[model samples]
Target: MKRLYQTVPTGCDWAVEAQGLVKTFGDHRAVDGVHLKVRTGTIYAVLGPNGAGKTTTIRMLTTLLRPDDGSARIFGYDVVKESHIVRQLIGVTGQYASVDESLSAIENLVIFSRLLGMGRKEARQRAEELLEEFSLTEAANRPLKNFSGGMRRRLDLAASLIAQPPLIFLDEPTTGLDPRTRNQMWETIRKLVNHGSTVLLTTQYLQEADELADRIAVIDRGKVVAEGTADELKASVGNSSLQLKIQHSYDMERARQIVEQVLKVRSNTSTETGRITAPMTEADRVTDLLIALREAGIHLAELSVQKPTLDEVFLTITGHGVKKDTAVDSSSAVEEVRV
Candidate 1:
């Protein structure tokens, strides 16, 4: 609840702040001392595998669930003590669409706007604009029951932005959408920030976090295993990634061993492609590696060095791949105190 910044930069304003937040459901400590600082008007992503407490952390910060320990402030307003004020400052869109099944798209948006205290005419106008912006004007009159998953997702986003609150919490906005539709959602999310709305989203898609977030926190088993920019997290894994394509398929294992010995790091070999990949702390080590490979009669067809990807960073930090599953914070058991 208090504005405290021991680790965050001094000059920036945080849209959401929480420190040592904890939550438990019987035996499982769902959220274990999670901490986050989202800068105003930036996209901050929480990336984690399933059941990693990403949703629990979001619920605590958004005042949907009470934390057993620590505290959080939304725009300097306490989520626990100043929940009413905090609610006014934010919007939340969960994974599932929260709209009336019998209502049309326009009707749903208008209803949401009106519920937020907008006049009927103003609500209708706002609904139309949102429908147009989300490219759902053609289906504005279609019933929600007939809408596709992507359409419903977009409408859900539009409903959440009816008031255009300062901060928005999106729990995997692009889940279950087609590639094209997912890209559209990404653009909309970017536009939200461009128009001065801060976004805090949780996603298991490593590429989504890498593409959308200004900063990312990787949570695993209810703990923040890593936090930083995509580049920073990647650098934490390795300074650069070295990739080698062997001239002979049978030589891949030998090449991998040579690479591991020369680079002094573990290397992965692809039997099919005759490729060897390893992390590199020094780029200059490539010369020695090439010499060693040549002496060992291992010829390289191609070679390259690049930064580590978010997938690699996830594997390195969490020791597992990302799992695509709905985050269960058990919010259904707790009566939602909607604002």
Candidate 2:
């Protein structure tokens, strides 16, 4: 297949690169030998379940936590030796809202701008422009304590972009948001890329990574177990399958029997979707199934080919579904960790 974007033609093309990155706390290895090569002007997702060492990796890449081993560069600057330069080029935001509750929306943005070395007039102008861009101008003067979760999330992102950094690190920025709000956050991330920014995202929401990331690295047990585009990862797990909705509950048994005999593989059905799925191949075709079912006097409500999902890919690679945890001190630990 044709490549989607141009490969890095020169040494300066990468936005972030690392090799053999390892971090340990006493006997525990939070991040073990993690590596990455993120391109310029695209979204790269580090996808993993909690306690999978995602936050520890971000800390090393952003120069917040010193790595016990390995090294990394951000747009040609060393994360450790040249951390000051790295800081100037990148923005980091995490799960928690970082704005002061007592401050107004405009006030929060202006403060960030000021901290970034903007003069009084410049800071005010930048804050106003960002408030407008993020669609928060209507509530710019309202205290942050009154802002909704979505509004506060947007404001936090705006603050991170105050200096217009070339690269941004978003550590699960959409966790705990309503569907509409999550979509809004996704749009905001896309807008950042459209404006010539490179983003490195860490997320457990498989769908979020599937939607936003141009490429993905699935981390399990503090190391990258898989890396590719969403489709590539999904394709790696298994083949596309045929999904059928039986017209009646009684038809399910007959359909399953016909499908098994035709495909020579076991079939699985779900009570929730009222669907049965089996691997799709030329030998197990819709026409053949329909013909066989017609002779057997069985009917199906729907039939379609379905590809594997990222969630399925995760379970396949990791051997289990992701277990949720909120304990900050644990291996999963991610909540606005800063530099």
Number of the predicted model whose lDDT against the real structure is largest: 1
lDDT of 2 by residue, 157-240 (tens): 998888778889998888788999899889999998998889999998767898999988888778877777776565444456
**CA shift of 35, model 1, Å:** 0.7
lDDT of 1 by residue, 176-261 (tens): 99999999999999998998788999998778988999988888778777777766665555756788999988888788878878
For model 2, state the Cα shift of residue 301 in Å: 14
Give the backbone clash total of model 1.
0
TM-scores across all candidates? 0.78, 0.74
- Model 2, 201: alpha-carbon shift in Å? 1.1
